[model samples]
Target chain A: MKRFWCLFFMIWPVLALYVCWIAPSMGWWFPFTGPTGMKAASPLGERIDDLFYMILYITTATFVGTQIALGYVLFKGAAATDEGNTEKAWYSHGSHNLEVIWTIVPACVLLFIALYQMDVWAQYRVKDSFPSETKQGAIAEVTARQFEWRIRYPGLGPDGKPLPLMPEPQPTDLYTVNDLHAVVGKAVMIILETQDVQHSFFLPELRVKQDAVPGLDIPVWFKASKSGDYTLLCAELCGWGHYKMKARMVAETEDKYLEFLQNLTKSQNYDGVPETPAEGAPVASAAE
Target chain B: MRSKLVALVLCSGMLFVCGCGRTEPQFSYREGLSPRVQEYVRTTVDEKFGTPHKIRVWDKLPIQAHTALATVGEGSKDNSLVVDISGASRPIEPGTEVVWVGGTIMPRGSAPVTVEAFTKDKNLLSLVAAPPAAPKAGDKIVIGPGQTLTHGRLLYAEHCQHCHGVAGDGQGPTAPYLNVRPRDYRKGLFKFTSTKEGMKAHRSDLARVIEDGIPGTYMPSFKLLKPEESHAIIEYVLFLAMRGESEFQMNNLLASDYSDASVANRIKDGETQEKVIEEFVTRVKEGEIDEEVNQRNEKMIADWVSAQAEDAVIVPKEKRNASDEESIKRGRELYLSGNLNCVACHGESGLGDGVQTYSVTKNTDTGKDNVEPGLYDTWGNKLKPRNLRLGMYRGGRRPIDIYARIEAGIKGTPMPAFGAKLTEQQKWDIVNYVLELPHELRTPGTGVAPASPATKPAPVATTAH
Candidate 1:
């Protein structure tokens, strides 16, 4: 029974280590697609994942060290009392030197981590540190309400180029719900706003998360390395229907992105009546 | 210690039993119906459309019943059975699965019987295997290669029941807290539709609403749902709407003579209680009420069928005019024009604060002046005109959507159709103006003079919260 008590404390950390070793292969690491588990689909997201793995390594080392120390003490204590030896137990009230060493070592580790992650932190949250392309203007305005993401994109100009997205909704703005499209391999920005409550816009694949505070316009930027659909969900529990904000962020080439905008414009102006011969003249006149 | 372990296991087993004892979900009837009326509605609806677990598709209600219903006929052997497939929506094919919905052939377990061979002309179905007991004549069976309604009911319960209610009465758990209530399909009326005025909404209109969702409202988009799943949900919604409409029509019939107020009035007019009660019993026995209900149901079905006709959809004669400054100027003139009277409900500057909103109006039903000074829809909810400056079009934001609104008019609201009075070009002009209202600079009344200084200033348009 005494040996059993010693074994119980030692078994958990070993079991935990086994689970961690097998987790990535089992596709149980990060909430993403890929066999190796640490799959970040954006350039910035890759850097973020590096920082995440760094912290995870530090924590795992600390956890293993503490657990071993605990198991060693339990094992020694249990083993000493296993036999019927008449011996007085040795106990101490305090160990000042050991306490000082333990405290100072953790403080140094904390300071090192604080200094190491400064660049990634600045790139993620600081507006001035954003890429040059994103600094020009946002491509779309994403307004998060209780249960949905309403996206507004600037309509095409006469030259067949997208107009700069306006802060306020323009008459020529194209509207869609729960679908966001952006050019791949380049930073695209979106002005995020909340109509009612606080909602956190989270793109799991791109590793981007921002809180859409009411009455505040927050700019969020990300560059997707792959051209595909990524999951966009709300991280904050804004309301009962928070799960209903299941959206998709599509990353494509510049030409394809522009083509999508053109299609949106055509659909936005569709008037049930098929395009008549007279329609071409007005479009030409407007272009001129 | 061993005894403690046994007790612990027993306690956990009890908890597992409790967890497994979940009650089945049920659809609640609309409130305010008398007990008798409620019972009649329940029995009639249930007989046609069975419970959620054993859903029966009533083919006459303009709903797409995916499964075929057939009654077992004579000369049924152990391996095969003859069935009358006249009531089915389509011919049941070979290899289709079958389940007994009525009579003595009870559903046994998870696995259902499948068809080995189907003779179309003879209406015969040979089973792949024999059941524990042979099926009897007159046993009702449902043939299903498609389980649309069942799939829809389960999905609706999981996703839509929180707001749309099990009965589609718009009184679900979260409904009361919402400012814009979920649609009550009981009246068989939808506000946003592309169909012409006085017609039921087209299936595509409902499908669009489900896919894109109604912006500026709590109904979120279900764009992630697969195409087949969406079709099933739409069919289930149609079933609920038809069922609710039947109950509503029956309520209307009872309202004239059997309402609480009507009963009290009869007693006040010196009629004995027994005599008044006898009148109701005699009417029920004579089947007069049943005849009335059947007629109304037929009319309702006809209305639903006609709405799906190709010509029922509204298509503009001409394409949209250009969005140039000249077109905008002409649209502004039409906005202030007395013939269109756009300023009546929509204010002079398109603020949705027109005088009609604050004026007392007579109630169409009671014929008395309403206590509240506001416009109301047929559903008795206070109606507010769309504030053009918001740029949030609930139906849709497309130019064609706005044109349809201007031409056919939004049903069940104070907005009226101008297609009969205005030409297609004029309607397009209004559509362009309305589309540009958000971007247009706000000036006090533009050209129109402000009301006399004595009158209260018009309400300012506040930003949506």
Candidate 2:
């Protein structure tokens, strides 16, 4: 029984290592392949995954080494108690070099991870890194309110004027009070706000999540890679109806998106006249 | 043994430390349901008519049937109370008169009502009635129909004042719960309907909404009021909202006139306040202020209200039948086509997935995208639109559900109220089309095969000059 117990203890770490190393890479039990069913976004997600594997391998090795040392100590201590070979058990001071090696190695590993992770974080969060000039551009505003997310898109009218955007500091520009949609392939900046409480905007496939803060603006950017229906869900608990605040988002080709927008604009009846800028007049800058 | 004892003690200490985390509040269905139902009844009734004097059960036993008993006046000894029956968990068989007696009657300006309910077999169900009324400092002003101002003010204070504020500033306490906050009553821009086309919401559109609360929001239905009461409330709410909006516009105008340094200096010298007040009074008396400005603001607000009314028009009682196969076919074609784009947001398969599923963008109004989730039904429940293939609609399997949604557009979301855009016939056709989407798009030999027809593209809209 004792021998069996020892063998079970010896095999557990190896099994755990094997499962951890092979499971995700093999995609045996993974769900939700990120966006395009791909492994990572940017080179950074892949790099981080690589670093994760490296740590896993190193830790597995260290665990094996420790197990071996423990086994050896247990065996040696038990065997040294024979009466004929009885002697004062040798007491050795802990090795300063060993302690130094373990401490320095872990410190170096942590430093490497910290430095590498900063770049990944910056790549995802930095607004400047956005590929705003791409053909399939990002032009959508996400408004998170109590238990619901309201999306707005600037639908162009018949004369080809884009509808006014909202949360525009000028009270007059609070146009399209609620209808939110935008044309495809246009660089759209979404100004986020909350109506009653805090909520979050999470797009899993786009790998973007931003909090919907009331009395403040939290901006997020993402370009749809394909024309498909994606889901928008609240990631925060606003109230009892939090779970029901689900909506659909459609990313279409430029022509199709524009066509959709035109249909919406034509159908909607606005009370105010369209605010047209004078020809050759200087355009007002957005609020800083 | 000593080491083992230490290890046990340490493990127990760790467990205690871990257990110190805050306990999460558990979801309670019963607690949430009762209050929601009660609030829904109260708000709906009050909005429909003025506050009721005594809302009680009608009978002595079998307390299933409840009624709203409102008194006509403060001190009339006659049978001034009008009792209207409302609410039933199960369908009430025709001619079944379920009543409960011994229910306490609370006066409009008095203390609480304590009532009890018993089964036909004498078992008790519940005893609680109305909550106690708070103390009032002044004698209640009795306003009759002829006194429109007094009547409007009394009604507004009772119903609209809680949310619209005493000054009509839309800063109501309950305003916080609404998704699309309560109409500031001061903006006068009703987002739901339009009246410019000589179209008005049929009486039922307003009454039904007051009866059958908006499905997914804080707006609860006031089903307890008689038809007359509901009409009165609607008028009262509208009057308050418009009056507030006009006042707000006037204030803005006055503020603009005092902006100049000389005007400011005069105000600083304590003369400007009286001058501004006099000017305001003169303008009110003359009523000849900027006609264009007033027209523009009025039109803006009128147009919004018109849109809401248009959206709220459910199919007339006559057009709800599923008789027109051709219209339904056309509706199906439209649903599949680019126009109405229902398939895009709902889904091609009618599973609510077209091109835009799970796509995240910011909301134009609130500025936060990543919206919570999509369309739900009444009952504050989450219900995805039926997969067209499945042919099931929780809102009722009738063609009217599809029609009303297409026409009115679901309130409080991205669903643009489509009433103003779609013709009444087209709306019905769309409903027929939605009902047929699942079956029409289904595979052949799947029990019920769709009638074969050529796929038609959406008609291109000619720009209105």
Candidate 3:
């Protein structure tokens, strides 16, 4: 019983370490790779996945090595105790060459990762590094309040393209409360601002998240290569209403997006002149 | 050997303990549902609505509000009340021949009605509601319960119906146990909407509410739900609201046309109930009833449709009058003003216990004053007027939140809207005064103190635009 118990105790860390290694692939933690699939939807998203896997692989190796070493020490110590020889076993100090190799290898690995992740970080974070298409000015203003997202779209002309940037407010500006609409192939910029408190604008699929500071218009741009809707949720705890900030991103053909804009514009400026020759009033179509 | 054995046991236990994760709020998805309700839901709703799901963008059909003119009853010529609103800065001008604003303008017990109509002399008018159409018996009811419901319906049943109820009546079994009862959507009224005073909530408003669940109540946020699911739930809630409201209208019509008293009288007089029903139908068709019920229905639908239009959210026309001492002083004066009725409920010192707190509970409507006095909400829970000094506002603490509360009054409670009675500046003034109450109480300040210790005036972040 004692021998069996000793063996079991020795293996516990190994099991834990094994579970940690398997957890991500089994969809236990993110970059979730298991049945509950979460995949990269953008270039940055892929880069982030790469950075994550790099850290994960390195961490797993370290974890296994450390745990096995710990288990080996326990096993050897227990064997000594079993023999009733309660003396520190004669141990040799680490070799100078081994120490040099160990230190240099880890340091080199760290250096490589640090240097490799720089561009991905710069492309993702630096405001100026954002795609040039984003500099044409924000296509929408997303004002996040305590519990909801109030989105305003640039007014489009009869040609289905956004009107030119101007210093003044246009009456044709289209507004929708929760849903953010963008053309699939076009780069959309959001001038995110918080009306009351701090909120993070996170689009998990697009790997886009930027804190919307109160009184600051932080520009965040994303271009959806695939045309589909994605979840856009608040990643910050603004208040009790934080969890329910489930807004969505609609990435569709420019025509469908224009139709959505037309509907929104029609709803907001119902009394104003027609922007497009589309149907009577855009039917209260919210679902497409 | 013994040490090894003990170590093995202890090691496994430590391993188990270490595996335990950080604590989180224990949220049950099917919260507070009895087995019976759950089973009934599965059989009735699922079989009928075709299994609930997430709402697609296309599922967001616009809600049309009622906005049709109601015909004045040609018979009630002498029942007009003259409203002297000339003193009120924004006096409502008589529309082009008595247009209906939301629905019918009907006279209720003289106090319950808004101005019915402007006399030709512009002095006397009926209160705003249309004349009560007599209730008639009906067999056809409960439309589309089993039809292909929108994806929102499934999500609503899965998440909301356990507390809100199948009929949106706020009578789910768990309702009785809740302190802040789930909202009853049948009246088509919501408390924390982003809508302006008296305006219907926007679809996005409903969606946000579902996502952000009411913080201090049983309404837990459905944040775990996919965005599509939340949108679907919003649609379903709106659908239920519309359905319940229509049913309420139907009930009103039936009660007016065929009340118990009228039925008893008809039986005593040897007149068949069938005969009365025929007459009622004839009256409806010929537009000979007090007002056309069909027209009122159309108007009701229009009111809902119009609610989807712009101006759903309340925006003050100008920059807010700064919260200076003068404003607070003026607010104090107005709060105690007899017409404002703030003191009657909020108390002289803003402690939330006003003189009317006790009176509001007495059954004046039912004339059962002999019963024990205790204020109860429509949910049948004891109603507590907001403790203004505590400053723990449940709706929110933002100035706009307070503004909305003052202007629209908290729905589902006894609070009455002052938007119709007071100006926007007045509402903001009240907000300032209410916020000041806690501070005044704490330090013996010159002005009104605020409601809670934590209720600091957080700087409002606004768009530079």
Candidate 4:
């Protein structure tokens, strides 16, 4: 019974560690790889995780070394034969050498980690480093309000070129108001705004999350590596209906995207209606 | 003594360290905390300390292997009943039997018996004799007459006072944000309706609006209420609206005595403040001075409310005249074709599923796209397009009612005021055409000869103010 108890105690910690590492990957804890699931969204996230493991390994080694020293000292003292010749254990008032070594070592380690993270963070946030082709190819604006995200794509202008970003005070040039569609293989700059309260635009797969602040324009940029449908979600708590704010982004080949944009534009204007109608009545009559 | 003292010192030191280092469970749901407080806690903690290892309800203590006593009544007369529940989880479900530690009695003669269950904290979960019986079909919940007033008071405190003001004066906390300020329930003029001139919304119409909600604006749908509950709320809303209107009219009457504009002007010029006050007080006391005026205004408001209610009804006499399946088929073709161009905005499915929806401007009020405010007819007015899928015709859903709207055009809106444009038979054809868009658009039908062309020009309403 004593041997069985000792074995059980030894095996418990190993079993716990096994569960923690393997359960998440095997779908026991997090069953899916989408939003709300535990999987990392971008390659950058994986890289950061790798850095975290490295630091953890170093700290764990230090902890184990100190614990072993403590155990050895306790064992030696327990075995000492004192029998009233009790000279108190030797005591040191201070240890300047030990203090300096501990302090400087930790400071250097922290500085190294901080310096290592700067480049990764900058690469993830800064737009210019992205390939020009990828940047230009997938451009769309996502506006968040209350509990919903509104996506806008710039359509080609009358000159058969992409419309220049309109200056303020000209409400007409805004992509959504003008029914603009983004051409494939072009950069999409999303200008996010909130109508009522605060909301966050989060695209997990793209590793992009930005708060939609009212009365302020927050810009977020992303390039889809492959063309498929992706979900857009509101990560901020706007109101009771926040869960319902959902939209979809469709990425397609450059040719297919252009075809969709042109067809959509043509459908907006019908051929049967006269360009200029006779007096009061203009174009087609049905309004209701 | 020395060894014992050393052992005691070591144990004390160990206790101190354990107590200082132990983690405390976080408690949520403190009273008076704003709803956003929890969100702020979650975000800030995640940003700083990283995610929690696990979350558990901090208030509940885990149950050990034992049974708790269940009591049923107050002191002395309290009866005990045995409920053999053990090692139960926190957040115990109702009807769970806990062990009764005391005596049980069968009641006799005029006295009542009570039963109760307790949590580990000694808080009462329930105090009843037995499980409630299931409700019978067609039987209403009878909570007694006083429940109406209790419910009304609670509803008013929760929803109405925030916008209608504590006194129903339209001076709500959110009043400042609204562009077209909230309706002073007292004046009682509602804008959207099929009502002729003046009218309070039909109780059902008010409930419908509240349930489905206005498409644009801050008014959100309260679709959570059941049918009967919504009716009760509507009643409460009407009560407040009427009470406020009466008060406003009384104030208006006291402020005005208009014998004649010239006479009033002369009196105003010559009279002192005291004299003016005296005259107003005297006129109000006599009750004869503005009786005619007050009566006229009151009647007008009542008539308007009545007219709106009448307009809200769905008349069935206007269903399609012919039973021929062939006519409906022909009508469906015209609906989708370029001649009518209904599909341009309404979409091919007539479910308001057009591609134009993606491009339509967002409504500033409700934050929905495709709700353009300037889509009114020749008259500069605000109009909303119909959402065909809902099938709740704004002007009454009857076949003829829809026919009339299509024929005359909705006066002020983008629903061009279509009577003269399409032929008489074509108008009927379009009606059948719309019905076909949703269910079966591809069906074939026999063609009907076109009716005689409309002779009179389409009548347009006067320009909006």
- Per DockQ, the best of the predicted structures is 1
Worst 10 residues of 1 chain B by lDDT: B449-458
> What CAPRI grade goes to candidate 4?
incorrect
DockQ scores of all models, one per candidate: 0.37, 0.01, 0.04, 0.03
Write candidate 1's Cα lDDT for B220-264 as tens digits. Answer: 988878776787798888888887887788888887776667777
lDDT for model 1: 0.79
lDDT of 2 by residue, B1-465 (tens): 999999999999999999999853211111122232324323432332222222221122111112222112223121111122232222222222222222433355543233333232321222233234321222221112112233334655555555555544555666665553444445553323312222433334444445544433454334434454455565555544444444445444433554344355667878755675566447645754545336645564554455456443443333332324566667666676776777767776566665555555345444664445544222222334436654433222334444445555544345556667666666666765565555453464342234432122112212222
Per-model TM-score versus the true fold: 0.84, 0.36, 0.45, 0.36
lDDT of 2 by residue, A97-150 (tens): 999999999899779867867765665556556445422322444556544554
lDDT of 3 by residue, B1-465 (tens): 999999999999999999997753211113222233224323322232222232221112343111111333323433353333222112233331232223333345433223444554554455455334321122111111212234455666656666677667777766767777778776677777656666676676676566555543556545446665565466567666655554455445555446656666776889786776666657645755425434555565566666677766665543345566677888888899999878877788787788866763554235455244556654345666777775445665446667767777776566777777877777767776766665565444445442222112122223334
Interface RMSD over true interface Cα atoms for each candidate: 10.4, 20.3, 16.1, 18.1
Model 1, runs deviating above 4 Å: A1-5, A25-27, A33-38, A276-288, B1-28, B67-146, B267-278, B445-465
Residue A107, candidate 4: alpha-carbon lDDT: 91
Model 3: per-residue Cα lDDT over A157-239, one tens digit each: 65667764332223344555567888786776777887778999988877889888876877787877677767788999887
Candidate 1 per-residue C-alpha lDDT over A175-247 given as tens digits, one digit per residue, 9 for 90 to 100: 8888899999899988888999999999988889998888878888898888888889899999999888989
Worst 10 residues of 1 chain A by lDDT: A279-288
**Number of the top-ranking candidate, with lDDT as the measure:** 1
